[model samples]
Target chain A: MIEVFFQYDFLRYSLFTGLLIGLLAPLIGVFIVVRRLSLMADALSHITLTGIAFSLLLGRHINFFAGMNPVYMGMIFAVSGSVMIEKLRHTYRFYKELAIPIILSAGIGIGVVFISLADGFTTDLFSYLFGSVVAISRTDFIVVLLLTSVVAILLFLFYKELFFLSFDEEQAVISGIPRRSLHLMFIVIVAVVIGLSMQIVGILLVSALMTLPVAAAMRLAGSFKQMFLYAVIIGEVSVLSGLFTAFHMDLAPGGMIVVINVVILLFVLAFTSKK
Target chain B: MQTNNPSHILEMDNVHFSYAHQPVLEDINMKVSPGSFLGLVGPNGSGKSTLMKLLLGLLTADRGDVKLFGEPVKSFKQWSKVGFVSQKANSFNSGFPATVFEVVSMGMYGKVGLFRFLKKHHKQKVREAIAQVGMEEYMYQNIGKLSGGQQQRVFIARALVSEPDLLILDEPTVGVDAQSVTNFYEMLKELNVHKGITLILVTHDIGAMSDYVTDVACLNKCIHFHGNKETFEANREEMMTAMYGHDVSVIEHNHAHDHHDHSHDHDDLAGTRS
Candidate 1:
């Protein structure tokens, strides 16, 4: 496997992206799960799916988009959708969760239109939807690398504020932490994570990559820091093992990765329940 | 208008707030002076939480001026000096995977400022706060594993970690046992007297808190009476009727010597803040 990675650039790129996503997904997932905004990730992933489909449709028609990667459009759409979700949640204050379904439906609605117009899932679209180990371009790797770095840096800078808001929003507000901007920043980060993660985990299974490791970590983690550390470890393990298994079996890495996470979740649940 | 008086920590003058078309607070005027332990008591919908929100700038008042630390709320930037423990403390994500030390350290985050790391002194302050609230033994314990009263104490420690001049607690003893409630009040009293921290406690138990607080305010859409504890105890009936409105059946229990004044007329207590 080590020799193979060294020989083939595609293998190296896929492995590198997989490891980075493994870290970034669970890092953001810890906050999402703690804030009870797990559904928001699902909604944003759907929105990214719409972006991917639309980009694929544009790739066929427009000369400019002909050579463009769908991940860029997916990120743009996901970030905008996250901002829109924040606005809509504020508009319907008492019915905040209503925003999730609204965006999810819009995403699916737009996605269906784009997929139909594109004459169905092309080879390109299928690779994005379910993820392909060999399909990751050098540009996608850089984009993921850059996004992961930005997210990690932002998290480090605002670590205390994020924990404060997630732990007790009212206290955060009273402490004058600029909570609205922080929360908006958080959702945008979640959106970008979902968008960037799709290249490795696929649009359909990105939220699982973002959430499942954290779910498993929560069972025995003693503290927030421990939960964060444990989640990243769990995520890295699943991604590496899933990638190896997918390489051997010629299967979708997305499905393999998510199944690995589900197995870990079940094991943790059973193990913790008995203790 | 901003008051130049250094003693007055909070001032809400003619503050009127409403939710949508329904009025929650009307023509409210109140001031919290420094080093005063104020017990804010009212019926369920009397806007105790709303008033706290206004002071904390969580909700902007539709019409009125709210000044904190002698600065207009819009311009007040010294949040580190004002600690607030909201009603949501008890209901905060119970499964949130954080230790007591982490939670207490969050209090100093504001004072520590942004884009900066907590220094050794900050950790020492967190430890000092944990010790202050007598939760030193549980510093490493997961917050979720603590009992309701113990969790409440950790929250108080979080509030005290910053060493704020004014500590605002909105029903801090909601799920705490009776003995713990007494201890919590005693802690607040000690915080007020020894540390000179101004305290505002919002709770439904007016009679129970009357003996502990230095001042009392009866709130029901408006400030019916705001005076010292002696005046509140002396004019209990009038304040009770002003709070509950028109019909209130006051009964003295067998342990009347304990000053347990029970008012069993809360039927008209909901949605009448307008």
Candidate 2:
């Protein structure tokens, strides 16, 4: 495996991308889970699929779009979808979770329309849907690195504000935290992370990467800080092991990674339930 | 046309609030002096929480002026001087993964501002706040594992961590046990009398809080009575009956000693009122 990574640039790129996504996913996931916004991630990932599919369809006709990275379009759509979800949540205040399914269904519905319009699925689309370890280009790797750095910096800057908001939103607002702007910025970041993660975990399983590690950590962690630390550790372990297994077995990395996350979660559940 | 009075910690004048066109608070005027423990007692749906929210600038009043620490609430940027613990604080998710220390430290985040880390002095303040509430032993303990009363104390510590000049609690003892509730009031009294933190405690059970609060205000969509504790005690029955919109018998009990028999007295009061 070490020799393979040294020889193959694609393998090295995938490994680096996988590690970055691993760190980013659960770092954001802790806030999502604690705020009961787990399904928002799933909804945002589906919307990212809409963006990717729309870009693919546009590329078929437009010469300018043909050379553009589909991930950029995916991010734009994801951020828009996040904002729409926030608006919808306010529109249906009593039924805030209703925003998730509404956006999710719209996303998949529009995504399928674009896919069909583009003359059905291709090999490229298949690689994106299930995640291909060898398909990650150098450009994709750089993009992932840039996004991960941006996310890390933002999280570090607003760590206390985010934690306070997640713990008690009403009190945080009362304490003079700019609740509306922070909420909008947080959701936009979540959407962008989902967009970038599609290459590593695929759209369908992206939310699992964000949620599963945090779920396992929550069962065992004594404090929020511990939960955050354990979640990142769990995420890194799952990604690294999943990549190795996928390379040896010729399986989809996304499926393998999510499976490992599930295994860890189940193991934690079993361990904690006894006490 | 009212001037900002430097002596009042909170002042609301000609305040009118309506929810979806239904009036909640109307033509309300009240002032809370510095270092006064004011107990805001009202029946359910009497706009007590709304009034508190308006004072905290969480909810905008439909019409009127609200001043905090001699500044208009809209322009008041010194939020560190005002701390609020909502009624919902007691009913928060128990599974929230936070220790007492972490929860208390959050109170200082506002004062620390954006793009800055909490310094060593902030940590010391957090420790001091936890000690003030006598939760030093539970500093590292998960907030969820503690009892309701203990959790309430931790929240109080969180509020005190910032060392606010004014502290407002909305039904902080909702699910607290009898003995713990007594201790909670005593701790609050100590904060008010000794620490000189002005308090506005919102509760429906005026009888329970009468011994601790320096003043009492009864609300029913408006300020029915706002006076010193002596005047409130003198007019307790008349005020209770008027604010509740029915006949209510006031049963005076010292919360510290007779809390066990307090429920029986409540049952008797209910029987008479009905």
Candidate 3:
């Protein structure tokens, strides 16, 4: 683990990026989970797959200008796709499952078209699909860092209002918190975190990182502050352990991290529920 | 009943609102002075909370105007001038994790800003609000661990943390224990007598109105009765008959008014600087 930390800068960058994601993913996850928007995060992450594929299919061109960092295009598509999802969910009179079909089919449709066009499905596209330790570029590292700072600063500045809204949007608004502004801010933050974390954890595994630590922490912490602290700590531990295990086993870092989170959750639930 | 003073804290002029073309509240013309405790009594879905929502600028009125402290409600930017504790439906009980102190301190969000980096003065104000609500013992305890009444008290503390001229509580006593209900009213009465904060108490508790509320407004999709405590005391039968529209029952539990003479030091928020 120490050797993995010291020998290569990419791994160091990966570790730092992982830690940043560790704190933020779960922090935002608390809102998604509370607002009963848990599935929206899932839908949003899968939508990132479309962007990931497009960045790669058009990878030969976009990367010609800015290197192989897929995040810029990834974020653009993620935010746009999320906006679409919002529109679909809001506009359609059908069930929320209807929005899922629209977003899911659109994401999968775009992803399939891009992947088939790229002709790099099995071998070259594994980084975007699974997780790639080698793909954590310096630019990706910087993007992750910038995104982490933005998410953290937003959360800190709006902690009380966010808490009130997450707990009770109706009451928070009645107390004069800007309802539309706060809700939009939360959605944008969720998109940014999911997009950046996709480089390391893959879109498939990121929401688990975002949500699991919070679920586990809620069972143990006596207050909301402690829950937040414990969630960050647990997120850090999962990311670090997963990165180290992936290095040793020659496995994908995202899968390893999610596994570590699941193990931690199981242990915590068993311990706390026993008490 | 001489209407001499033009210094009403809250006023609604012919307010009209509807949901999907169905009228909910129409022509709500009421004026409340500073330091008066007006209780909104109504059956379920009678627009009690909706009127409070209008007061706080949550729901826009379809027509008419809402004025806060003589200024238009829409024009009042700094919400700290009006403290509000919404109904208990907003409370987080299933998976809530907040200490009483943290939850109460959240009330100061408007005044102290969103961040928790409070100065000493802000800290003292938070503590004072918590103590005012008789929640000092559980200040450090997790809010989810407390009883329903204790949680409501924490919310009241939070609302008061900003210390506005008008404090609006939407059914603050419902679902709480009987002992806590009386205790909650006592605390409210103390705040009214000492701080002279204009209060709007929305509840269904008919018997407890005289003890805490200076005025009562019974709502049944419309204003069945809007008048003073003395009038309610005088026309109990008529008011109940109008409220229920039939042979409505009233278990006249006597609530003493003698305990409202307590003293304290407060003008409540910055708007009531007298």
Candidate 4:
């Protein structure tokens, strides 16, 4: 396995990006789970799918855009979708979560149209939808790296603000924490993570990568710091083990990683129940 | 009554608020003098929470001026001197994985600002706040594992850690047990008296809170009565009339009321107040 990882640059790229996503997803996921906005991630990922489909459709028709990475377009849609979610939630304050389904349906609707117009589902689209280990190119790895750096800096700078908001939103507002700006920044970060992570975890299963580790950590962690530590550890372990299994068995890494996360969540639930 | 006093920490004049054209608060005028414990009692839909939100700048009043620390709320940048604990403080996620210290430290986040880490003094202040609420032993305990009363105390500590001059709590004792509610009131009293912290508490248990607060304001979409607790107790019939919009019987609990007897007293008061 070690020899295979060293022999294949694609394998190295997949493992490296997976490790970073494993760390970054749950780091953001802690806030998502704590704020009860887990489904917002699913909504954003679907929106990314639309952007990918749109980019693919454009790639086939336009010579200038033929070789462009769909991931860039996906990020644009994800970020805009996040802003739209914020706007819709503001517009319909009483039914805030309604923003999720509205975006989700629009994403699916537009994505289907784009896919059909792009001459049906191809292997490239399949890689974007269900994830392919070899689908991650050198540029994709660089994009993930840049995103991971941005996320790290923002998290470091705004850790307390994010934590404060997640723990008690009303208090955060009353304390004059620039709640609107910080909230917008947070969801955008969530959007970016969702967009970049789908390259490895697949659009369908990205939220699991973001949430499952945090869910497990919530059961065992005694403090917020411990929760982060436990979540990242769980995420890394799941991804590494999943990738190893997928490589050995020649299965899809996205499904394998998510299944591992589910097993971990079940194990934590069963074990923690005794306490 | 002391509307012209510059010492008022919180002032709302002719404040009118509504939701979708239905008036929630109408012609409301209120003032909080420094170092006074003001208990705001009102029935459901009486706009107690809305009024607090207006003061906290969480909601914009449809009409009128809201001044905090002598500045209009829009420009009231000295938020470190004001702390708030909502009614849902005790109703937050029970499984939220945060330690008591972490929860308390959140109080300083606003004052500490962004991009900077908490200093040692800030951590010490968090410790002091936890100790102030008598939760030092649970500083490392998960906040979710604590009882509702303890969680309420942690929230109070969170509010106090900032050392705010004006502390606003909205129905803070909703889910707390009877025994702890008494202690909660005592803690508020100590904070008010010793720290000179102006307090505005919104609650439904007027009878229980009436015994602890220095001033009382009875409301039902309007300020029916605003006076000292003694005056409020003396004019119970009129205050009850103002609270419920009709002649209502009010049970005034004597000083000898014990924890077990509170239910009887509360029931009698709830019957009238609601």
DockQ of each: 0.72, 0.77, 0.45, 0.74
Weakest lDDT window of 10 consecutive positions for candidate 1 chain B: B265-274
In order of DockQ, best first, we have: 2, 4, 1, 3
Candidate 1 Cα errors over 4 Å, as ranges: B1-5, B245-255, B259-274
For each of the candidates, give the backbone clash count: 0, 0, 2, 0
Model 1 clash pairs? Answer: none
Q: How well is each residue in A46-127 modelled by candidate 1, as lDDT tens digits?
A: 9998998888889889988878888889988999999999999999999999999999999999999999998986787777
Clashes by residue pair, model 3: A224-B97, B163-B269
TM-score of each predicted structure versus truth: 0.93, 0.94, 0.90, 0.92
Best by lDDT: 2
Residue-level lDDT of model 2, residues B242-271, one tens digit each, is 888664544344433564555454344234
> Please, what are the lDDT tens digits per residue for candidate 3 over residues B112-185?
65445667888899999899888899988887777888888888888888888889888787788888888888
List model 4 lDDT by residue over A107-177, tens digit each: 99999999998887677877777676777777889889998999989998999999999888888988878
Ranking by TM-score: 2, 1, 4, 3
User: lDDT-based ranking, best first?
Assistant: 2, 4, 1, 3
Off by over 4 Å in 4: B1-6, B245-250, B253-274
- What is candidate 3's lDDT per residue for A83-187, written digit by digit as tens? 777777778857755786788678878888888887755764566666666677678788788878988899888877888787766657756677777777888
Prediction 4 global C-alpha lDDT: 0.87
Query: In candidate 1, how many Å is residue A236 off?
Result: 0.5
Candidate 4, residue B141: Cα displacement in angstroms equals: 1.0
CAPRI band for model 3: acceptable
How far off is residue B114 in model 2, in Å? 0.9
| Poorest stretch of ten by lDDT in candidate 2 chain B | B265-274
| Model 4 docking category | medium
Better of 1 and 4 by lDDT: 4
- CA lDDT, candidate 4, residue B162: 92
**1 or 3, greater by TM-score:** 1
